[model samples]
Target: MWIQEVGEYSKKLLDKGTGEDVVTYRRVQGGEGTKSSQQRIQVNGDGTVTIPKKDADLNISIDNGEHSNYFKNEVRGGNADIVEFDVPKWFDDFLKENTIPQSGYNSNPLNQGGTAPKLVDPTKPGNSFEVPAPWVEWIEEYAKNAQIKK
Candidate 1:
């Protein structure tokens, strides 16, 4: 049986003007613990807070609530080191402005008014077809550029 003894938890405002604070907690035996601290600027008349855009020490955000446990597991395993940036107001507007219906690739041959040749299935034994001339030429050019021999 393993037991964790937590001790010495403290919270202090590092910068009261900026609403920046630090909360530190430590465990007694294994020296393992968690500290969750956040700083935000109160947006005037908006009832919103703005988190600063800076390199984080350890930041993780998940859209789905179910993934929270998984995040905790990673933190315990010392695998949670990636820092994430909270999307800004302008990013949401940009996403709305650039929104488009999902479709085939913009550079797809079919979309570009080019006929794409259908190749025979290679999984079927004894089923084969001659490679298209244009495709062969393209492969030849690609190999020449890559300096690879067939």
Candidate 2:
């Protein structure tokens, strides 16, 4: 166990528009949630990826669509995201009891940002960017209508 979930329960977006039959969110079952965390994406030789996370180590096949593109174009080049990381012992125990997802998607799902975000887990040192919460379903709303903006 290397990753975990530690946050308030989140909801699944049922619908996102105003109308008579619209629901913005729905309750997720207990012990099931989405949480955000900084993860290490390790592309493997067998066309797969190994993500070490607080929840569990995820092995993903890079055989189609974006996964394939990412493996081919960015894995061994400057586009590859590299960071120095060290995991503490306590966090491992925490993951044994919770779920920290290794994958997520943005609401709009487009690759059109000129600048990537600079996010850090303020609790740690050296530009730390790791799991933000233990477990809580999360989604990126990087759009014009985003509620959070600088």
Candidate 3:
């Protein structure tokens, strides 16, 4: 039989202005008796909380419901690091204003006013085609210039 005893716990206030704090939990285990102290929780200055990734008793769910599915099984013993990324709001506005629709591309071709080749496939649902090399070169040039900041 295995046994786990939760010993004395302590909570200390870190940055009172930012409402940051840290909680430590003492756990005792093993056949005879072994004592170990772990920093169970930490509140950062930026409002982000940090917790031990291993040997920590935690229960997490998507929406905080009682009948929620177990999320620990989804780990599959892979990398557990969580990453965060930021995107400028202007990028979305620029794409919406600059991008050409599929219909617009079909109407205009690189060879402008010249007859373009077409292929019909009965199995496919809609017209499938590739853009001309001239258009691709122009797009690449535009992307290169757009990424540069003045």
Candidate 4:
């Protein structure tokens, strides 16, 4: 069951972008009557998943720009950046079990602040602004339901 869940979650992240990635953080369990398990999966540069000490939280971010020609053009010109995913035990095991590629794992260019050409607005003619629809959607969905334990 855990394996299947991890696979599905990982697939969703990959579907978002070729250069996209994910991070999984496991929380140490404690206390009586509390499940001795908790986990979080963050889609670097976009969304996050927090499996509270009890319930699981899923946050998915889809980058519409990835589906756009402009983004691909930037990648071709070496101006495109890649997001990273920190492998979780479940995901790691799944990768090993399926023998899938692990090239993108732990490779987050955005976190490293790698240099990439800023997305330009073609319609604006000389405007060097890029729409962050992917991050926007991620924030809208994840931020709204995120549990803020302040």
Candidate 4 ranges with C-alpha deviation above 4 Å: 1-75, 100-150
Please state the error at residue 25 of candidate 3 in Å.
40
TM-score between candidate 3 and the true structure:
0.17
**lDDT tens digits, residue span 1-150, model 4:** 522433343323222333434322111122123321222322323344332222222222112222223322332233322222333334334332332112342354532232211222324211122112332233233331122110
Residue pairs clashing in model 3 are none
All candidates' TM-scores? 0.19, 0.20, 0.17, 0.20
Clashing residue pairs in candidate 1 (N, C-alpha, C atoms within 3 angstroms): none
In Å, residue 32's CA in model 4 sits off its true spot by 55
| Tens-place lDDT digits, model 3, residues 36-110 | 222222334443344434222222111111111111113211222211111122322222233232334457553
Q: What lDDT does model 3 reach?
A: 0.24
State the lDDT of candidate 2 residue by residue for 1-150, as single tens digits. Answer: 222222111111222332222111111111212322233343344323334443432221111123322332333332233221112223323322333222231232321121111122223221211233222112111011111100
User: What does the lDDT read for residue 14 in candidate 4?
Assistant: 28
Error of 1 at 47 (Å): 6.3
- List candidate 2 stretches off by more than 4 Å: 1-76, 100-150
User: Which scores higher on TM-score, 1 or 4?
Assistant: 4
Could you tell me which 10 consecutive residues in candidate 1 have the lowest summed lDDT?
Answer: 1-10
lDDT (10s digit) by residue, model 1, range 52-138: 432222122212222323333433333322221223223222222332212342455442232222212223221111222342232
